[model samples]
Target: MSALDTDRYHIFGVCTPKDYCLFVDYVIDEIKNHESSLLQRIQETPDPALRVWRESTALQGTDIFEIECVKDRETAQEAVEFWRAYFHSLGETIIEAGHLCDRLD
Candidate 1:
């Protein structure tokens, strides 16, 4: 379990290896393109959406990723929606590419 697991809600998912690679690249580019704005958002929000990506660790040899979020059901739900939007923006669907689950630790 992650250190964040104890106090945070988690959004977990599994995707194709291909999609996982694509997501990593996309997030890298996104950070590059919006560093200043992203940083400002991080500074202003105690639990910014991107915090999950920042705190996550890619499971070696698997397509699973789990995002830890602030321990609020509403915040967890928002993160779930955020990921769904991301998949949609990438021309994918959660059902086709993988699945998402939320839980508090």
Candidate 2:
């Protein structure tokens, strides 16, 4: 099993007419597809300096995913193309994003 636990869930919001079911479904699909790659990327890169928070914000009506992940200092630019493809396919907006590492402490 992955060293990570369920408690380390990706926390994000999906607004779909306030319908819990739709929101849940969106989160579920996103978690399934992005979780593995994200975890792997996060793991392969050691220091917290390499962390990035992938975020998406769809407009009240339109369907777009605005994903912004912190650029790896070493890489020198946000991997927008990779993340954009993932989030765009889902029709969600990549609104706000940043980098973060899970700190037990």
Candidate 3:
């Protein structure tokens, strides 16, 4: 079993059931495949009603797929930076650079 960190980040928002399902599928695949694209991960939780995630790697729980990356400090920083840039590129007003990112060690 992969160890997960819960106090790293928080992902939450609004989206639809279909979107949430898609998000979950995407997340499962990403984690399974060990894909490290912060942008894709950040946007995995699509749009519709409500969706939330974080950096705890616990997105494998609850509804509306969440991405809480619970990695070590070193690896976690890299993930956070990647997501920060991606979130900025997405131009998400609510999801700022550090929205789905964890503070560096």
Q: Identify the candidate with maximal lDDT.
A: 1
Per-residue accuracy of model 1 over 1-105 as CA lDDT, tens digit each: 674445445454445454352222111112233444433433343443334432452323244455443565567666666777786688763442222222111
| lDDT (10s digit) by residue, model 3, range 1-105 | 433433433332322333332221112123323333434445453432213434332333233334454335555455545554554466542322233333211
Please report the candidate that would top TM-score against the real structure.
Answer: 1
RMSD of each: 14.1, 12.8, 11.7
True lDDT of residue 67, candidate 3 = 44
The candidate with the higher TM-score, 2 or 3, is 3
Q: Give the poorly placed runs of model 3, Cα more than 4 Å off.
A: 1-65, 68-70, 94-105
TM-scores of the candidates in the order shown: 0.41, 0.22, 0.28
Global lDDT of model 3:
0.36
Alpha-carbon local distance difference test for all models: 0.42, 0.33, 0.36
List the candidate numbers ranked by TM-score, top first. Answer: 1, 3, 2
lDDT of candidate 2 over 1-105, digit per residue (tens) = 544322333333333343211121112123334554434533354443322221222223222232332322322122434443455568754433334333311
> Which candidate, 2 or 3, has the higher lDDT?
3
Residue pairs in candidate 1 whose N, alpha carbon or C atoms collide under 3 angstroms: none
Q: Poorest 10 consecutive residues of model 3 by lDDT?
A: 20-29
Comparing 1 and 3 on lDDT, the stronger one: 1
